[model samples]
Target: MKKRKILIIGLMVVGALALLTGCIPGDGSHTVAKPAGFFSGIWHGWIAPISLVGGLFNKHLRVYEVNNTGWFYDLGFYAAVISGFGGISLFRNKKSKND
Candidate 1:
């Protein structure tokens, strides 16, 4: 029963995604604004995983911008990637009375 329920839910989610994808209107000429500057790079990096998934379904979508301010954008993107992937723990309070 549990397996059947899971399968049904998965199918529903996939169907919804297909429907949404179908709703995207255009002759494939819709251009998404690429992320620029440090802040935008950070934001894009943070959402990179999601962007990657979205990009898989839409050929026009990109996970990272091609044109940016170089080093600053790279730095921000690295920072965001590190922070998003558990690097924030480096600044956490590790001293607990119990330990």
Candidate 2:
């Protein structure tokens, strides 16, 4: 019974993720006179999770800008991604040797 319950929950989670994946970064193509730069990339990276959720309901919304400054934008985006998510591990409490 426990295994069946787990299986159902797992499937639900996977289904939700599959649905959400449609809104992932770089999936949309838009044309803009002014392309996003490094700072915009940083902001976009920080708000990526929110954008993903928003994008699902709003087709116009996207996690990544289609018009951007290439390498600089990519660097800023990746830097923010690594720092924002990966930095969370830095604050975790470590187990004491006595414990």
Highest-lDDT candidate:
2
Listed per model in order, the count of residue pairs whose N, CA or C atoms clash below 3 Å is 0, 0
Off by over 4 Å in 2: 1-31, 90-93
Record all residue pairs in model 2 with backbone atoms less than 3 Å apart, i.e. clashing: none
The true-versus-predicted C-alpha distance at residue 11 of model 2, in Å, is: 35
Point out the worst 10-residue segment of candidate 1 by lDDT.
Answer: 22-31
Of candidate 2, the 10-residue stretch with the lowest lDDT total is 22-31
Across 31-75, the per-residue lDDT of candidate 1 in tens digits comes to 355436787668667777766778878786676666666799789
Once fitted onto the true fold, the runs of candidate 1 whose alpha carbons sit more than 4 angstroms away are 1-35, 89-99
Candidate 1 achieves a global lDDT of 0.69
lDDT of each: 0.69, 0.77
